[model samples]
Target chain A: MRRADRTLGVARGLGWFSIGLGVVELLAPRALARGLGLRGQEGLIAGYGAREIATGIGILASRDPTPWIWGRVAGDALDLGTLATGLGRRRGGAGVALAAVAGVTLLDVLCARALSSRRERQPVRSFADRRGMPKTPGQMRGAASDFEVPKDFRIPEALRPWTSAA
Target chain B: MRALVWHGKQDIRCDNVPDPRIEQPRDAIIKVTSCAICGSDLHLYDNFMPGMKNGDIMGHETMGIVEEVGPDCRGLKKGDRVVIPFTIICGDCDQCKRGNFSVCERSNRNKDMADKVFGHTTAGLFGYTHLTGGYPGGQAEYLRVPFADKTHIKVPQSLTDEQVLFLSDIFPTGWQAAVQCDIQPEDTVAIWGCGPVGQMAIRSAILLGARQVIAIDCVPERLSMAAAGGATTINFETESTVERLNELTKGKGPEKCIDCVGLEAHATATLDSIYDRAKQAVMLETDRPHVLREMMYVCRPAGVLSIPGVYGGLVDKIPFGMAMNKGLTFRMGQTHVNRWSDDLLRRIEQGQIDPSFVITHRIGLEQGPEMYKTFRDKLDSCIKVVIRP
Candidate 1:
C-alpha cells in the first residue's frame, strides 16, 4: 500500500478511536471520572467526550485532516495536564489511567507529525475512491527495484525439491 | 560444536553436534552469537509436529557473525554480523520479486510434501520441522545459512543483538499482524496472548495508531507485561473476556482482534477448550482454535482479524459462518520476514521503539533445554529467551 494510504488509515483509525472513547466518556462518565480520579467531575468528562466527538467528526469529514489532527495533539496536551493532576492519587486506577493517557498522547503526537510531513511533501494520490481492487502483477511490479540475479544463481541439490523453477 | 538438539518429545540436549559448513553455493557459515528459543519451538518440543527427526538442531531466531561464504554467495563476507530470518527465500523467485519472501516458490527443498499437505509449498524455514524444509537450525555454535544474500540482514556493530535480534521473526510477525488489521485512526485492537509476539503486537498497534488495545491472557505476569506495554488487560480465568470486551467497546466490539496463541491454547474451564483437548488427544483434531472463536465473537462487523499465531493442520468448531456473516477481514500466515526487517531496523535506530522490551531472560547456550521447559511452562515469568552461544 502507498504511504498516503497508510497515513490516512492511521488518521481514520485515530478518528474512530476518538469516537469510541467519546462514546465511553459520554455514557459512563462516572466510571471514567472515577478511573481518572476525577470523582464528582462526571459532567466535565462528558463535556470533553462531546468535544472529542466533534473533533473526530471533523477529521472524518475533511479530506485534509491536518488541522483537526493538530487539534487532537492540543487535546492530548490538555489530557496529559489533566491526568497529571491525578498523579498524586497513585492509589486506585489513577496510575493506570495516567499511563494510558501518556501512551495515547504519544500516539497523537506521532499522527500529527506524520500528517504534517505528508502535507509538506507533494500531493499523494487519494485512496478514498480507489475501491478495493487487487493490483495485477503489472501494477505491483513497478515498485520493485531493479536488481540483477547472479548468472550462477541456482538452487542447490539438497534444497531443489523445495524450490520451484524460476 | 555444541548445539541444542531435539531428541524427542520433552527431550532437548546441548550435544556435541558437528559445526555447520557452507553446503550450498549460496550458503554462508555463521558463527552463531545470539539465538532465541521461539514459542513455535515448543510445538516441536511437545511432539505436536510431524517429521521432526532426532538430533535436529532446533532454532530459527538467530544472529551471528559470518565465518565463511560459498563461491556463489553475494552481498556478504566473513566477519559481518547478521540477523537471520527464519524463512529462507530465493531472491530471484517470482514471490521474492513481489516482496512476498515468506512464500518464495523456489526455497523449500521438500515442496512436494508440503504441496501434498497444504496444497502449496511455502518458503523453507531454518531449524523447523521437515514440513517447512528442515534446514538445520541456528541453536548451535555455527549455522549454515542458505541463500545468505537474501536471508541474512547485516547489522552494524553499534546496535546490540537484543535490539535487532527479533527482526528474525516475532517483531515482524507482530508488525504484520498490526498492518493486516487495516487499522483505522480510532481502531481498538484486542489481542489474545501476552507472549512476545502479543507484546510486540500491542506495541505495533499503538505505533500504528490503535486508539486502545485490550490484551487477554490468564497469566498474571503476562497481563502485567501487556499493561506495561500500554494495553488494558483481562484475565480470561477471572473475568469473562467476551463480556468484558463487549462492555469495553459499548457492545460494538473492538475493530481489530489478534490471536497470538495458536494450536496449544488452554482453557481448562471452557467447554470448547475441553472438546478441543479431547479431540486433539484422540487425533481427531490438530489444532485448538479457542482464541479464533473468541475473536470472531468479539470483533466488530467489518473488522479485521489478524492471526500472527502459528497453527498446523485442521481445526474443528471454527466460527466460519460467524466470521463471514460479520464481514470480518481475516489475515494470517507465516510472516514475510524479509519485507519488514529493514524498516523496523530503521525504527529501532531512530528510537521510535525499542525491540528489547520483550526479552525477559537471557542465558548461556547450555541452558537451552531447561529454559525451553521454563518458557513452555511460563516459569519465572519468562516472556522471551535469548541464548548467547
Candidate 2:
C-alpha cells in the first residue's frame, strides 16, 4: 500500500479506537476517575470523553482526515496534561495511565506528520489542455447552431425575451 | 464470458458467467467491444440505490457488433455495429411515441415492482437496479438486448466506440439537461459537479450558446477540464459557491442551473452536507440534496433547474417553498437516450464534440473490480473509465 493509504488505514483504526474509548469514559467516568486516582475529576473526564467522540466523528466523517488527526494529536496533549494532575495522589495507577496516554499521543503525532508530508509531496495534475474540442472554446461556441431546440423543450412563449414585457 | 458482477456493496467481481442468448423474439445479442463505467453505476457500486441483488451483472454505457439476432429484430442484423441505449424502450409504447422513451411502459419485465416503487414503471435500464428492469447490463463480453429492434442506435463504422458509446447515457443526458433549460443566447448556465456528465453538460451549454457557463466542483483536474470546455470553474472547497455564483452573475443568479451531483453529494465542506451525512448514517434519509438546495437558492426567479443527476429514494431539507415561490421549473428524470441520440451522433460525426476526452482510464474486463474502487474514490484523477471487454 502507498504510505498515505497505509497511514489513512491507521488513522481510521485510531478513530474507531477513540470512539470506543470515549464511550467507556462517558458511561463510566467515575470508575475511570477512581482508577486514575483523580476521584473528584469525573466531570472533567466526561468532558474529555465528549471531545474524543467529536474528534473521532470528525476523523471518520471528513473527506480528508488529516485535520482531524491533528485534532486528535491536540486532544492527546490535553489527555496527558489531565493525567499528569493525578500523579501526586496515586503514583502507580497514574503513572500507568500517563504511559498509555503518552503511547497513544505518539501515534497521533506520527499519523499527523505522515499525512501532512504526503499531502505536500504530491503534485496537482492539470487537465487544462484537455478541451475535448478541435477548436478553441470561443470558436466552438454555438457550433451546433444548425440543430433546433425541440418544440416540447422550448420555454413558454411568455417567458421568451421578446415576448415578455420589461 | 467474463463480466463484472455485483456480489454485494463494494463487492464487484470479474467472474466467469454463462454467455447471454436471444431469450425473446425481439432479442439480439451483441459481442460487446467497449463498455464504460458510468457515474450512475457508482450508485450501484456504493449500494446507494436499492434493488441490486447478489450476482447482478453491472454496466450501462455499452456498444458492440451484433453477433446474433432473433427473428423479430428487423433493424439489426449480424455484424451491425450498435450502441445500446441505457433505457430499454418498446418503440410502440405511448411514452416512447411521445419521445419520452425513458418512461416506456412495456420494456421493464419487473413492472409491478417498479410501479409500486416509482408510482409508474419507468423504462428498463441495463445493469441498473431491479426497480428499473433488473435486466443484465452490458459490462460483460456479450449482452442480450431485449426489444433490440428499437433499443439500439446504429453507429457508422467510421466512428470509434469511444466517440459514440456515451450516446447510451451521459452524452444524451447532458444534452437533454441543456435542452431542458431551453438555453438562450442571453442565458448564463451554471452546472454542478464536474464529473463526466457535468463535463458533457458544460460542452453542451457552450454549443447551445449560453452567454456564460460556470462549472462548480472541488476536484482540481475536473475543474481544469471544465475550464478547458469554456466554463468558469468553481472549487467549492476554496470559495463560497453561493457567493461566487452571485458575484459572477452580478447578484442576478444564473438563468439555468444543472445538478450533475446527485444522491451522494460530498459530505464534507458545508453544514447541510454534514447534516445529510448524519441523517444518512442512521437511515433517516437516503439522498443528499445539497445541490438541489443550492440550485433553488441561487437560480434566477422563473429560471430552470435541470437535473441530469440521479437521485434515489427520499431526501430531507429541500427548500420546496423557495422553489415554488420563485416559479422555478424543475426538470429531472433518467435520460431519454433515444430522444437526443441522433442529433448528438451527428454532432460527433461533424466534429462538434469528442466525448472521448472524458476518458482518463482504460482497462480490460479483468480490471473491472479494482477500477470500480479507483473510480469511486476518484483515485488517479479518474473522470471516466472505459473497459475493452
Candidate 3:
C-alpha cells in the first residue's frame, strides 16, 4: 500500500525550516552569541551566516535603496551583534549561558526583520556615496578595490568587448 | 499435442513421442493446461542450446493441472492447479541445503545421479538440450516433474489464467532480478529491456521502493508499457541512452542496473522501424551487445549489478576491467527455484505483487507448434504466452 503523502510532505518541509534556522544563527555573532549561551566565541563562528546574508542581500539590493538597504543592513547587523555579545554579557566576562545566547538570537532575528524593512531605502551616509546610484556591472567593477577579490582574477573578459564612446 | 523435437541445426518437426509418466519418488504428472513459448525454447529451435539430440523435447516456462503423482509425493493432489519453475532441484543436496537450488548438486546433468544418490552433487533439468538434463520438457499435453513438492508453486485459486500464468518464468525471473540487486527505499534502478522480464523488473523496482526507474526499449508498445508502469522510458532507437541516463540522474546515474534481456534479447543496433525491418537481422541466436556495457556505463560506482538473464558459461566480449574498476558487485545465476517460490507465492497470495500482469496471450495446448513459431518469429503482439490444455 502507498504511504500517506501528507506525512512525507510535512517531514521534508520541516527539514527546510531547520536549514533556515541554522542560517539565522550563523548571521550575527557578538550581540546574539552570549545571550543564547553560545560558548567561547562560538557566536563569532555562527555570525558567518549573518555576514553571508548581509553581503548577499547587499549585492542583490544594489538598486535605488543601495545605501539605505545595504548600509543599514551592514551597520545594524554589526551593532546588534556587538550589543548581544557585549551588553547582554556580564561586565566581568560573562560565562556562557544558554538563555543569554537564545536572547541574543531572538534579537538578531528582530534585527534581520528591521533591516529587511529598511532595505528599501538608498545606502545610508555610511559606506560610499550613493550618488548616481544603481551601478552597472562595469561600474561595480570600477568599485572593485572597495571589496576584496581573489588574487587569481581581474576585471572579467565579459567587459573587454565593451568599447568606450570616447 | 506433438512436441517440436530439435534434431540439429535447422532440423526440427512434430513427433508423436511416447507419453510422459511419473518416474521419481517425488514426481507428479502435469497435463499441461497452459504453457507459454519462451525465448529459451527458441534456443532449442535455433540449435543454440547445447546437447539437444534428435527429437529432444523443448520448453521450460509452463503451468498445468496435476494429472497424477507418485505415492511418495505428499504435497500435490490430483487435479491440483500448479505452476512449475523452469529449474528443478531436490532439497537434500548441498547446493539446495545452501538455498542455491539452481546450482543443486543433483542438477549437474553430467554427473551420475545414482553414484552420489545420497550426497548427490547435482540433478537433471527438463528439456532445452541434453546439457540441461536430458529429461523431456513440456512441449506436449503432458509433462513429468521430478521434485514436485519442491519445484512447483501452487497458484492461488482465485487468480485467472492470465494472472498466475507467468509465475513459471518471466514473472519470477524479474522479481529475482529486483531482489538480487537489493533494491531498497529510494533506490534508483534502470532496467535494460521491455520484454516480459524487463517489464516485470520495472514493476518490481517500484514495488520494492525504488524512487525512480528508467526503462530502455526500442519497441513502441513495450516502451509504452514501461511508462505505464511508472518508469521513465527511453527509446534507445531515438535517443542516446548514455545522455538520457545522465540527464535523468543529476549525472551520477542510477544506483542499480539490471540486464533482464540477457545475451540475446537486445534489438540489433541501427535497425529500421518496421517489425520485420528492425528484426531482420535479429534472430533467435542474436547476441545482446552494448546493452550490458551500457548498463555498466550508466550504473553508479559501487552499485549492484544483478543479471537474471540466462547466459551460458561461454559469453565473450565483456568489459571485466571496467566492471572491476567501478567496484560493481555482480550477482547472477539461475533462480533458486525451491528457495524463492514459497515467499514469492505468499507475496502473490497477499496481493503484494501480481506476476500474471506480463501474460500477453493464452492459447490451447494443441497450438504449441504454431505458438512456438509465432513467438519465435515475434509475429504476435506477445510478451508472455500461455497455452491451455
lDDT of 2 at A73: 89
lDDT of 3 by residue, B1-389 (tens): 56656677645556778888888788999987777677667656655455668877767776789999998888889989998888787778777777777676665455653234324333466776555477778766788898888778788688765666667777767777877666544467889887778887777666655667898876666676676666788888699888999999888877788887665553324321122222222342234445667777777877777888765324435688888898777777766665556665665666555666555667755566666655554445556677665
CA-only RMSD, every prediction: 19.9, 2.1, 31.2
- Per DockQ, the best of the predicted structures is 2
Candidate models: Cα lDDT each: 0.81, 0.91, 0.61
Q: Which tens-of-lDDT digit does each residue in B1-389 have in candidate 2?
A: 99999999889999999999989999999999999999899989988898999999999999999999999999789999999999999999899999999999999999999999989999999999999889999999999999999999999989999999999899999999999998888888999999999999999999988889999999898999999999998999899999999999999899899999999998877789888877876789999899999999999888889998999999999899999998888888989899889888988999989999999999999999999988887778899999999
Best by TM-score: 2
**Between prediction 1 and prediction 3, which has the larger lDDT?**
1
lDDT agreement of model 3 with the native: 0.61
State the RMSD for candidate 2.
Answer: 2.1
TM-score of chain A of each: 0.69, 0.81, 0.25
Going through the candidates in order, their DockQ values are: 0.01, 0.60, 0.00
Give the winner by DockQ: 2 or 3. Answer: 2
What is the DockQ (computed on Cα atoms) for candidate 3?
0.00
Clashes of each: 12, 0, 37
